[model samples]
Target: MSYEDAFAAMAAGTDEAVANALELFPSEIQTISIDGADHLLITPQNLDPGLANHLLIHVHGGAHVFFSPETALNSSLAAAHAVGARILSVRYPLAWKAKFPASRDRVVAVYRHLLQDYPANQLAFYGGSAGGGLILSSLQHLLAEGTDMPAAALLLSPWVDVSGTGDSYAVMSGHDPVIDYPVSLASAAREYAGTLPLTNPGPSPIYGPIESGLPRILLTSGTRDLFLSDVARLQRRLIDAKIPVELIIYEGMWHVFQTSTGLPESSTAWRDFARFLRTAWAID
Candidate 1:
């Protein structure tokens, strides 16, 4: 099937669509609460009981507008199972209800809470699309406060630049079937930030400085994705800062293809994510 067709099939709806897409991967899902907010914890039922010490904190992608922790439950579970780790999927406040600093603050708070349970060295941050943006933004916020960062980070098709300065924003415009247009993304970012600068490091992390000693990052993107250039440029900036980063570019794929675990691309991406998690955390 073509990229357009694949995206159309995946964009149907978060609950039914995502659950159906991830049915092939088995995960144990449960509903829980964090910091007074409801969340979903997804873990592979067959995970080695001994490896539960390792944990992955996942933020779901919805362009900061759609989806919820329940929407990404299956994928998070599969990833945790794939790496034999536990998963925490945060149901963060959305752009429409809570704007900048607010949304970013909630995520940072959750990360801080997680640190209370698991050592920073044993935890990893995982997110995709807008969630990817959140992960980077949260790290910058924590680092500025001298807080501990995660051991590593995994970002899939990250929308790093809220400024939308990426060359591929126009180059891949028509080629990317999932994202409607750059205007829509920009509008959401503007609304999410309210009066905050679009280029603010905590708002658009691609324009921000990489913190020294931050966690190593594994970034994945597709050539056809609208955020391709943003991902590439972020990687370049990270490398220039002497930060450890691994980038994987999938040919002809669109944003967050791995969310569609039914596809071969999604399967490969998850396998890579699992391996990266194990290596980053030094899981035996």
Candidate 2:
């Protein structure tokens, strides 16, 4: 099934159709509310509550229009496993229903709430695709409001350039297994942007300022991923701005390919991801 088809299935409430199309993970899922939005706490069954200090706030990817905390439970668990951290996965308001800044606002609010329970330096953000872009957007909002930033972030093939101006969008067209550009990606960006221009830095994030005081970020993208160029662009911008950043380009993987747990490359990526988190958290 195409990414667009899966999204439509999800939106149409065709549970079995979408469920059969995706791989899921086993996690202890808990439903919670923050700032009037649904949020999920998904943890490894053996997760220790004492490690709450090392929190991973995940933003599930769905092109900003598909999936929910429930639909994305397994993917969120994969991240929790990769980082070895308890997760507070944000089920932020989706686009097509609520537009630009709605998801951003709710994420920031949840981040603030999480901050009250854990120190800013102990928190981390992880997201793939649109969720990855939202990671940057939420940080931009927090920074603009003078709120404390988290310790670090991980962007899995982040769709940072909502305008779809990246070269990979064209260059890697047929090579990419997921994400059909111009049509699939651009349409989703429009739905999410609503009345806002796609170039609006607050919503697009790639157009946002990259400077000091933002959290250190680790970004991963496959060479075949359509968002590779956007991830590369943001990495360079971060480095140019003198912010700490790391970019890992998988030789021939597709967008967020680490979710394909059966692949040996996926295992390697997860190991690297875990190591990155440990280094960022200053954990041995």
- Root-mean-square deviation (CA) per prediction: 4.5, 3.1
TM-score of each: 0.91, 0.91
Q: Which lDDT value does model 1 have at 229? A: 88
Model 2: per-residue lDDT, tens digit, 1-284? 64467766776663543353233444666778889877888767546454657888889898898887766654676667666678888878878778988899889889999888889888889889999999998898788889998888988999887888878988998789878777677778888898889898977898997878899999999989998899989998999989899888889899989766568888888888878877888885
lDDT of 1 by residue, 27-75 (tens): 7777777778877777776677766787788988877776677667656
With candidate 2 superimposed using the best TM-score fit, by how many Å does residue 192's alpha carbon deviate from the native? 1.1
> How well does candidate 2 match the true structure in TM-score terms?
0.91
lDDT: which candidate is best? 2
Q: Candidate 2: deviation at residue 258, Å?
A: 1.3
Q: Give lDDT per model, in order.
A: 0.80, 0.82
lDDT value, residue 115 of candidate 1: 84
